[model samples]
Target chain A: MDNFDKIAVIGGGSWATAIVKMLCENNSTIGWYMRSIYAVEHIKRNKHNPNYLSSAELHPEQLDLSNDINEIVGKYDVLIFAVPSAFLNSELEKLNESLENKVIFSAIKGIVPETGLIVGEHFHQLYNISYENIGVIAGPCHAEEVAMERLSYLTIACQDEKKAKALSKKIKGRYIKTKVSDDIFGTEYSAMLKNIYAIAAGIAHGLGYGDNFQSVLMSNAIREMKRYIKKVHRMKRNINNSAYLGDLLVTGYSVFSRNRMFGNMIGKGYTVKSAMLEMNMVAEGYYATKSAYKINQENGAKTPIIDAVYEVLYEKKEAKDVFEKLTNMLD
Target chain B: MDNFDKIAVIGGGSWATAIVKMLCENNSTIGWYMRSIYAVEHIKRNKHNPNYLSSAELHPEQLDLSNDINEIVGKYDVLIFAVPSAFLNSELEKLNESLENKVIFSAIKGIVPETGLIVGEHFHQLYNISYENIGVIAGPCHAEEVAMERLSYLTIACQDEKKAKALSKKIKGRYIKTKVSDDIFGTEYSAMLKNIYAIAAGIAHGLGYGDNFQSVLMSNAIREMKRYIKKVHRMKRNINNSAYLGDLLVTGYSVFSRNRMFGNMIGKGYTVKSAMLEMNMVAEGYYATKSAYKINQENGAKTPIIDAVYEVLYEKKEAKDVFEKLTNMLD
Candidate 1:
C-alpha cells in the first residue's frame, strides 16, 4: 500500500464504478478521471454514478475526481484504465503527461481499436511504458452482479508477479476473490476472444438453437480460444482457468452482455446499423470480430465459430445458413 | 450394415425414444424392448411413446416392439441400452440371452448401482463381453430438443474405432450430427461425472449465485472433471471434446435436466425425500453424486464440487453453508 496507494481509475462505465467501489474497501483515496464533467458532477452530488451502478454509494472524501486526464495521471502512480477499447486511444490522446514512470493496469478487456493491439502491448509500444509496468484485470465478474454485492472472482495478470499480487491485495474483499497470474497476454486475449464467442452464442439462441447445441458450441469455443491465444502468444497457461474459460462462460451465457444482445438482434433480423441504433451500448465484439477475423487469418487456428460470426455479422450472410454450416463444423 | 444391422433399443425413456427416432431414419426395422407391454401397445397405437417424448412420432411398422428383454436381445446383433443405471442390474438380470457376441452400446449416463461399474465396464467384466464389443453414446443432445428436431451433436465412443464410426453412421441423420472416438472409458466417465456437476450448478443457482459464479463454477468443474477422469481412466482424451465438455455444458445448463431441477429443489430448502417425491422422473445425479464421491475417494482426485454436492444432498448439509465453503474453493 505504501508504493501503490495512489491508484487512479479511468472511464465512467459501470465496470469502472464497480472497480472504484471495490478499491474503496481498502484505499482511503482513489483518483477518478472521467471525460464527462456532467457524470462527475452527478456522482459528486448523488454519492453514486447516476449513469451506472447507481446503487453503489461513494464517499466524496475517498475520491480525487477530475475531468483532466493529465491532472489525474500526474497525481497517481498506479493508473487503471477501464474505458472501452474503441475510446481508449481518444482518452490517452488527452494525456500529455508521460506514463513512463506510472504502473499501469488495464481493466479494459479488449484490444485498442486504433492499433489492433491489446492494452498492455499498446502501452508498451506507443507510450514507451515498460512491460513490467503493465498489468491486466480479467474477470468472470459482471459489473451488475458486483453492484448487487454477489461474490465474484478476478485474475490479475502482469509480467511482474509482484505488481500483480500487490494490486490483487487491494481488490480482495468480502464479496471479491482474486488470483494472480504471469500470463498477461493469455488472460487479455482470452478476455477479448470471449466477447466474439458470446456474440455467436446469442446469435445461436436467437436462431432457435437449444441448450444442446449451445454447450457443444461452448466446448468447441474454449478449444478454439485455446488454439487462437496459444498461436498468438505461446505460454504454458491452462485455457481452463477462470481468467480464460470462466470469462468466456459468463459473457457468453449472461443476459447482461451487450455483445450478445447486439448479436441477438442480428440473429432476429436486425441489420448492423439498426441493432447499433437500438442499443445505446457498444457490443465490442462487432469491432473485435473484424480485428480477430483478420488477426486469425495470419495465426490460422481452425476458428469455425469466429468465421461464422464474422460472416453473419459483417459479411451480410444469413444467420440461419451460417449457423447451419457452423453446426456441421462444431462436433 | 453387415453384421450389426439387427439393432435393439432397450429402455422406454425419452432418450431411448430419441435414439429410436434416429435409428428409424436408417433402419426399416428396429428391435425395441420395453418392460411395459402397455407402453408398447400405446406406442403401437399412438405412433409415439405414451410416457416420454410423446411428441416424437414413431412408425410401429419399423419397430419390433417387445415386452421380453431376451426375445429382443436374441434377435438383435447390436444392442443399445438406455435404461437408468439404478434399474440396470435388475433389467440385465432378466436377460437369459447371452450378450457376449452382441456389440453393446450404453446410453446410460450413470454407474450400475450394484457393482458401482459403468455400463460398459460392467458388461466387460461381469458379462464376459470384450472391451472391444462395448461402446458409449454420449451427447450434448437432449431428447426434448431432438423431439423438436433442433440440431444436436452426438459422440459415439468405442475401443474399436470402426465400430464407433459404423454406429455414428446409423445415428447421423438430417438433424443429428455424429463424431466417432476411440475413448469408451473417457466418454463413459465424462457422461457419469457431468450429472454430478449439473446438480452442483443447479444448487448454486438455487442458492442465488449469479451468472458470474456459474461460469467460474463451470470452468472449475471442467478442470476438476479432467483431473478426476484422467486419474481414474488415465486416457489421452481431450477434455474439451464434444463427448466430455459439451455433454457437461448441456446437462448443467438445460432446463430439461432432471438432475439440475432436483438440485434446485434441494437448494431451495426441500428435504431430499421431499424433492424426490415431487418429481415424477429420476434425477440421475442424485445417485451419481454418491457413486462419484466414493469413486474419487479411492482415485484421490481433488473433487470439491462433487464433494460439496454429496455433503449437501447425501449428508444433509445446508446448501447455503456448503456453497459458502464451495465459493472459496473455486477459482
Candidate 2:
C-alpha cells in the first residue's frame, strides 16, 4: 500500500546506518535519530559513518539527521528502533507519545537487562502500544554486509500478519530480502539467544577446539535455543530457521564475527575486560550472556550453552575449563 | 531390544567404513561387502581406506571384508546399504533373499537414477518388505568428521516411531548421536535435495558472490527444500529441524563438504569434467541433480534449485550465467 512515507531509524550504529541506506535506495526520505552530536554532525558533514562502515559512503541528501528524538520520531510513519538493547527503554521513553500511531519495529536483538523482556515488549510497555503496532526485524543478517551492498535476508515478525506483510513490502529489495513470520516472540527470542551461543562458540574456539567442535557446539546451541525459546514463548521455532540456526552458525564461526573474535581472544587467555576493550565494539554476547543466564534461571529453562557462557564470562571460569565442562555435557 | 549382533555394511565407501568402525568400537564384528578387489585388498592389507578417509586407521581384527555379497549378507543380522545411489538397486538385488527379517537401513542419500525412487522405496519394492523394515539416516553430519571421531548427529526415519527409537539406541554412541522421526519420505527427500543446493551454493561461491548472497541462497534453498519435500511426501516436516534445514546448511556451506567443494571449483572457473577429475571423487550432487530433476518432473513438484543445478551441470550452462539466471528467477 506504500503506507510508510518516511522511515525513522533510531541509532547511529552500523545496523541502523545500513538500514537507512537501504531504505533511501527506495527513494524514501529517512529520519535517523542519533543521541551523539558528533555522529549526527559526521553524517551531515562527511555523508558517511566512518566508525562502522568506512568503505561505503552514505548520501547525506537522503538522510534527515537529528539529535532531538522528538523531532525525528514525529517525521516518519514507520519508526525503526535500531539502538542497543541496553538503550532501547530510555530511547522509547523519549519517543513514547510520538510512537502512538506509528508502526514501531525493533531491530535490536537482546533481552532488557534484569527485566528479561524482549525489546519489542519493552517498547510496547513503555509506549502503551498494542502488539499489532509492534514488529521485529529479526534475522541471520548483519549491517556490515548490507553496507557493502551484499544480499541479506531477515524475518519480519509480528503477531498481526497484515502488519508484518506491510513492513515486509516496505523493506524488501535486492540488497535486503524480508520474510513474514507470525512468531514475533520466537523470532526475537532466537535473535537474542544466538548472541549467547556465538559467545559460547568463541569460547570453544579460544579453548583450542577446532571447526568440528565449533560445528557440534552450534548444533547443540540450536537444540538448546529451541528448548529455551519454546519454554518461554510457547511457540514452535524451527531450530533450523535462518533467524535461529543459520544466524548462529555464521556468527559462531565467521571471521567477520566480533563476538566469536572476542570469544577467541578470551579462549587464547585474554581477560574479558581486555578482550572487550581491545575489540572497541560491544560484542552483544557479553551482555546477552548475563541476561540470558538470568532469564534461564528465572524461567527454570535448561540452557547448557548459556550456562557455560555465563560461567566463563562472569563466574571467572577458564575458557578451557568451560570447554571441558561443555564437552563432558555432550554425551 | 538389542535386535541384531553382526552388522553388514554393504559398501566400501567412507560412510560404510565409518559405520563399521563405530560398530567395532562396541565389540561387534562387522561384515563389509565390497565389489572391488583392490578396495578389499587395501582394507585387508593396510587396514585403512585411502580413498574416502585417509586419516582413519581401520582395525582388521574387528572387521570381515569380502567381495562376495552373499557371504556378507547371509551372516549379518542388520544390513546397512552404504553404497552409492546409482549402485543401490543392483546391490539390493544381490542381497534380496537375505534381507528378509533383517533390519535394512540406507546410509545412501539420493533417488534411484532411472526409477526416481528413494533407496527405501526401491528396497520396499525389491524385497516386498513393509516400510517398517526400511530405515533412512538423514543428517546434519559428515563421514569425514565421523571418521575423525568428531561428534555428529543424525535422524533415523521410518513410519514406525517405536522401531525408529529402537534402531537409534542400537547405533547411537558418544560421538554418533541419533534422533527418530516419523516423516521418512520427507527426511529422505530433504537429504537428496540438499546435495542439489550444495551445488548451487558452490556455483554462487564460484561466481564470486559474497556470504550475503550465499546466505540468502541457503535460506531460499531451505524454503524450496521444504516446499518440494512437503509436496512430494505430503508429510508435516519441520523445515527448521536438524534433519532437514540443519543438514542442508552445514552441507551447503562447509569446507569439509565434497559436494560444496566440487561446486566451488566449478564456480571458480573449473569445468564439471575438470572438477570431477581434480577431486578424483564422486560429487553426489552431480548424480543427484539428474535424479532430482527427473523426480520433480514426474511428481509435478516445483524445484527451481534442482532444475537450475540440472541445467548448469547437464545443459552446460556457464556457472556465472546460471547464477545470473537464478538471481533473476528470484526477482
Question: Which candidate comes out best when scored by lDDT?
Answer: 1
Assess every candidate by TM-score: 0.98, 0.85
DockQ of 1: 0.84
Model 1, B36-148: lDDT tens digits are 99999999998989999999999999999999999999999999999889988999899888886899999999988888888898998899999888999999789999999
Writing each residue's lDDT as its tens digit, candidate 2 over B1-331 gives 2365667789988788777777677655778888887888887789888676767888887788899998888888778888888787677667545567777788888877757778888878867767877788777777777777776667888786777877677678867777789887888888888888988888887777777667657766877887787678786656767777667866886876778888889889888899999999778778888887876786776667778888888999887777777775541
Task: List the global CA lDDT of all models.
Answer: 0.90, 0.77
Q: What tens digits encode model 1's per-residue C-alpha lDDT throughout A287-325?
A: 888888999999899999999999997899999999988
Quick one: how many clashes does candidate 1 have?
A: 0
Model 1 chain B, TM?
Answer: 0.97
DockQ of each: 0.84, 0.23
Cα lDDT, model 2, residue A233: 82
Indicate which candidate wins on TM-score: 1
